[model samples]
Target: MNDPRSPAQDPDSGSGLADWTAGAADWIARADRIAAISRPATEILLARLDPQPGQRILDVASGAGDPAFSIAERVGSAGSVLATDGVAEMVTALEGRARERGLTNVQAQVVSAESLAFTPGRFDGASCRFGAMFFDDAARTFGAMATAVRSGGRLAALVWSCDDRNPYFTVVTAALDAVGADPVEVARTVFELDDPEEVLAACRGGGWVDARVEAVGFPWRLPDTRPETLIDTQSELSRKLRKRMEGLSADQIERARGIVAERVGQLEAAIQDGDDLIMPAECLALSGRAP
Candidate 1:
């Protein structure tokens, strides 16, 4: 649900983001909620990157430009970021956001990681958040990124850890299973690459060396959000449930909503901050250096 290719660099744009094309609206709508929940990981990502002024950075899978525009702010006017994704709709949303923020140094486009057009050693460093797990081929995806970065520049990101430690993902998912809908297949789950060894192998296969993996986790915060707002942002649940209830009545939607609310309430009752909720989560903060 993230990242973009540069519109100005249409020559490099590809159609690899079909998976997210129709989901663009959902991604944009959920961006803010996602940000609040993911801040814990993003904080660690930025710390490890320590992006410098005047550095050319690449923000891959920069959906709604999470750390991309945020990085653009840190790099200031001297540095720029090429935020890219395979979905044009997602890039369009990012473009709107950049304009709203008056970010002249940031650019969004429909670029695929499989077809990066930059020259070797083109960037000072790169960043990707949760986007790595969705790639069709993780190794080749990172390899392309490595080929584009300068030596000494590192790529850092936050990836979901195992499901057991990240209950925010599993709690709601388990609820759906209890409701008789099959959960997303484990192979297709976002935490598929939770294993550090798998990540290390991907880094090495991608021409990135000196890799490091660090634990970074936090609660799924409800900052400026609530159960209803949070519910709409649940991608896995919304998507699967929508298909499961395709021909049902409005009553069915309402019933499903009630079930989710009850399930979520029970899971968070112990940790609820009045109306605010905090769900436990686990993630890995990783870095890979260009050779």
Candidate 2:
């Protein structure tokens, strides 16, 4: 079973930074695949943020620069986006991607969400996608974001809804359990902020007013239905699961891998898709206004 601690108490918040730093290169390599899967949620967040031309936007925990780059395009040359991540490696990757795309309007920086050291009201809008749930101090981080935005500016965040509603996460947990490997630690942190009300309360506590939550669901479509592809992709994407597998013996690891393959095979048989597997994913999009 997973732990029942609140988001603030979970140690993964700190470890998650280290994990992301170590996996930065892998994430960069798979950035396009991830971006495609997360585009729907990004659209939801952008709609809530309501960014406009000639405006400055702040993207906190901007991993591989998905919405940041998207926002940069939306804002055009007249506006700018400051993409900040706590991990320097992530920032470096983001910079590389921005440069490759010739995005002069997007700037990457190594800034922690809890310690956003920008001038007061420096941004017209801010966003954080799939990053809020891993925050060590949600209220403090959100408050810092609020401080950086002007009055009435919007703040939008996207977080995972729950384990059951997210097949991408549950599949791995089920695989681990099937092989008798403990998945409690990984499961605990991934869904820490699954509750929408908790996100609303945190935003309100951080001085963001008129906070509301919306549910966003999308299909995480993969081009291949192969079990090996699923296992390899999930292993690369989930740092906690990868780290856990690293501690297991070769036989134990093989057992878990086999379980994942079996489960994925079953899914393939049930779905009967010719070349693709579409996993259902759900996220909570929270929007609020700065005080």
Candidate 3:
């Protein structure tokens, strides 16, 4: 789930919208890769939301639509999920993903979490993953999500815990920074929303009752991945860094890729789960109920 806030409206040049819009196809291609990492968090969020069959749900900032698709399976034929994101390109990709699976119960819409066009109290529950942190106005955007939930409905979100605990981003980011990347852009993502206190505050500000934040460790495994494959995945996954690195000569890019792979590969080898390369990661799962 995401803030639904469009990057074009974001004041910061590093807001991630331009690159995301320009390279949505890459994000779609790597959607399964992201799903591999986020699957665990989605389960945690689903448990928090507790959606039953016949319930109506919302997933904000549903980039590429994993948690949404997973939720659709949980809700089954009787239930429905409205997946949304302000990025039209993301929304389009989500639609295709849903169609590919023949998931008629889930629909993708281009909308912002800061301003929902849905009817009041229309949703039984709502969930977001890896989206809340990028919101232009988190309080208002999260609040808008809560507003869409019916009375006594639940809201759950997944966010990064701390950069130190997430080598998937930290190691590569550190390596990239060493090569003259913009610290502001590199530091802006997972690190920005790493604080649980901020997550709690956003829930409270969003007008949710009995809000709480908890830290959870997630295992990310890239199965049978080669160094080159890992580097390509990292390049596409790191939106900002990939955008900046595009201007580099092919040799420079390859060298930078090697540096990142070397750093991230160390993480890949740290813990191998079966033949898969496992990268240890952690996140904060925040949940609350609309009053």
Off by over 4 Å in 3: 1-19, 179-188, 226-232, 244-269
lDDT of 2 at 99: 94
lDDT of 2 by residue, 165-206 (tens): 786777766776666665534322658899988988888888
lDDT of each: 0.72, 0.78, 0.77
Instruction: lDDT for model 3, please.
Output: 0.77
What's the number of clashes in each of the models? 12, 0, 3
Give the per-residue lDDT digits (tens) of candidate 1, residues 166-266: 76666555544555654432224578689988877887788888888876667777654355444444544255545554554566445555665665666
Instruction: Please give, for residues 1-291, the per-residue lDDT of candidate 3 as tens digits.
Output: 333434443333555444345556677878987887677788888889888998889998898998999989888999999998867878888988899999999987877655565677989998998888867677787788888899999998988888778877666566656666554343136556788888899889989999999998877776775544555566667666677666667776667678866776666434655666677788898899998
Model 3, C-alpha of 92: deviation from truth (Å):
1.7
Over 4 Å off, model 2: 1-15, 182-188, 226-229, 243-273
Stretch of 10 with least lDDT, candidate 2: 1-10
Clash number for model 1? 12
